[model samples]
Target: METPALEVQLQTLPSSPGVYQYYDKNQKILYVGKAKNLKKRVTSYFTKRHDSHRIGVMVKKIKEIKHIVVESETDALLLENNLIKKHQPRFNVMLKDDKTYPWICIKNERFPRVFPTRKLVKDGSEYYGPFTSFKTVNTLLDLIKGLYKLRTCNYDLSEEKIRNGKYKVCLEYHLGNCKGPCEAKQPEAEYNSNIEAIRQIVKGNFKESLQQFREQMKQHAEKMEFEDAQRIKNKIDVLENYQAKSTVVNPKITNVDVFSIVSDEGYGYVNFLQLSHGAIIRSHTIEMKKKLDETDEELLELAITEIRQRFSSKSKEIYVPFKVDAGEDVKVTIPKLGDKKKIVELSQRNAKYYRQERFKQMKIVDPDRHVKRIMAQMKEDLRLQVAPTHIECFDNSNIQGTNPVAACVVFKNGKPSKKDYRKFNIKTVEGPDDFASMEEVVFRRYKRLLNEGEDLPQLVIVDGGKGQLSSGVKALEALGLRGKIAIIGIAKRLEEIFYPGDSIPLYLDKKSETLKIIQQLRNEAHRFGITFHRNKRSKSALNTELEEISGIGEKTVIELLKQFRSVKRIKEASEKELAEVIGVSKAAIIYKYYKSKKET
Candidate 1:
């Protein structure tokens, strides 16, 4: 690997617009970053005095540095965002929060009402807020609607009354919740004034609005209107409760971002809490299964830098539960006292809580022990360059040379990423030629990946020894991924593992947890492949007669099968039973076959 090529490219870049990529020696991308001034930003890392520990580490591993200079900064920004999304760079600040924040939209009507929305529209509708908590936003919406009796219905009042001239006062008018302009029960001017009260309430101006309500209550009390005074007092109480609940924790810091990382074994979880004016505005969480050797401090530093680059800063202080050794002049503090402490404590608690949840669900996978050992032994046994993080396994299945299907299962960080699991029907090779079927499936898979210039898996395991392994390896090499990814042949005995080079079945060391872990992984892949193959065979057998019959096409066969149940039953059915099918005829040759088969 020409590792220095990466460093040289970074050094030779001109002070102009461009994008730069950092790739490991194997050409797998570590990070994708774009810069408006390519030479200044890319070359900054090489500065002797300015070399931060993180930058130094990144520079040392720069095996291949590629650049693309765009015409403008805007183009660079767009390209940067796109590449970040496409590659999901390991070092970039990722938007861990996939759930969108909600905004309140008020229709552009004379009597507008609030609606919760995730998307912003350029239509005339007005919107406010991107509230973090659904409960908080919903409660405020209800309180305002109850107090001011603003219409909650989406019906356009102005269009109904003016354009269509169709209107009516609702029950809210009788309940004294609304100033009823529709009924003409309250003056139009009074109703308009009530609308302004709603506007003030939503803008968080409760003091001014409450003071006016208080005066109204007092005047009613002086007039000996006890019932009216009590009603106004109740409204004031509701408003006071809302204000009390909306207490700002840290007024000095308007916007603060807090981060926390919890690690268990090799897995890491990063959590972010965004606070605006001392109140939490949003929170984000990301769970990672990284290399076991990657340190917590290193992961936290990378995660923080990535997050900061993605979310624009609104606060002067950034809180982190883990100590970051970035040495940046930013206020990096573990909360010691007061509300900041409480916020940090809450965030830590949440991170731990989420970690525990993941741990519980993932307890079935004991990768830390048996699986890791098995993989390491397999690597040494196969003379692999590194421990595999991403492994793809292939297996072919069929019954008596009947239906052939292939399965591909992916394991990331020693655990099955079932999302990437794939099943393929043997297209090129038919009738249970396991070796050729494996070749076709593997070839089809890698050809597309190589054509797209995609990353190959760290290891590819075939379910058979030399024959199957050779087929898979040849396919990979054809796609120019042969030496790039490790290849292993796992031919299983009744209760043991058989490798290509070794004649003896390799039973893992009984004492090693890692060995047992690898066995479990191999077994899982076998089980998944077998399951998919069985399903394919079963479906094919059931559809065999339909596939073979000429005049009895798909639709007719489908109707006959639906009405008769199975192929076995369809073949055994009398002609009358076949004729009873909605689309089948009494004189149909297929029905005669069914009748003859039943008689025999």
Candidate 2:
């Protein structure tokens, strides 16, 4: 970021309010900001003599800039919030938080009771707020409970007293907490009216509801109900305090979601903060990964696209990690001032924290400078005469006797090479024959490596015991690559490590770092292989019954399977529900056959 470049970007910006983006030399987003006057705001960063060290650092890294001119300052503010959330750039003040908004859920029942909740349920309950503060929401709930005398207990009074003939209403009525309509102590009409009034307050009708409460308070005082009047006044005060603290909304900016993406090396994290009518509502994070060799520009490009595909199409504006290369559907920019600036700065702070955490995990003071210790550990544990630059592990997957597959996952240094992962469909092995599958996969893999004249792996690992290890050795022997590549086998529990022709399994000391690294690699390979295998098996199971059904061709069977998960669920469905399934009709002869089988 330089003064001349800042001036150049500011000169081109529109006067309208929107988001702005500042990018570093590697084209990573350095900072995101929102501005009311884009030109005036962006230019401030260049001319300000008393800029803080954080801003100075950001300015140094900035090589490129971008902006989006939105409808109003409020839109700019919201878009800025979204971008900061998405990018988490490096020069902002972020609120220390994971606190989500709370909502008041009115249970769907004969006697509905309002409850405070963070998660919204789809079971016909009316959810409100997603209030800024949990304490405020709770206070309101308490006020409603005190004023209405509604049953706070979740237990069903009607079901308990009427249907089951259970216990009687006890203390709630005597203590004035509940109306006790369960035993007809209070009239249904009065209780229902109070419930409706509570609904009004939850719906944000504070002004009207306050007047009604005051009128009721006056009536209670006339009847010498001093305590009741005081309670009503307290409820009114709670509503006023909450309303005063909420952000004032500008009519133009009704709904907006802010996003920010921060990347360092090959890793990135996206933060999302949502606002409705200028009130902060929702927030989330998205983590990204790249190869250790990947550049900042390359990583940011992928991260922005991923964030857009996931969160942008549904949102009005897309705040990004850096200015996109162009041809994006939504506008992107960095904020220069106002509300959006605060959000962008916050995002930067979070990104800095995220990057720092990643650096700590890498542990090395200078990761670029390879240590001799790392190389030595790699050589001895893999049992290669030379240090292994690349390690490849293999595993076999199948369910009983079906959909067998083998996986080969590669690792560079100690991390996964996801791009080099390969899967083999077992063409020869039937049932859960791990040994045969290992042999076939090993032969096919190495045969290609040799034919292609590719660099041979210094080490090869198979996730199995002696039988699979022997199969791997035989495959390598057939290819004349047996001694060229060092092979090792990992066994579970008592049998830890095995190699072909070894008298006993080899167990590394528990305290060895080399063993820990190898175990991690082995677990990752097994996990990847098992996940693919199980998915294939499940698909096979779902296809089996459909394939065997007479009069059900592949197309019709595919349609039915897609609509219903299993044959059993489909059979249990009524004729009407069955007819609604694609390619199924009441008049179709196939329907009659399925119905006959269901009855039998």
Listed in order, each prediction's TM-score against the native is 0.47, 0.38
lDDT, candidate 1, 18-80, per-residue tens: 678877778877776656689888776555542134445666666767778888654665566
Candidate maximizing TM-score: 1
Q: What is the C-alpha lDDT of each candidate?
A: 0.68, 0.68
RMSD (Cα, Å) of model 2: 24.3
Count of backbone collisions within predicted model 1? 13
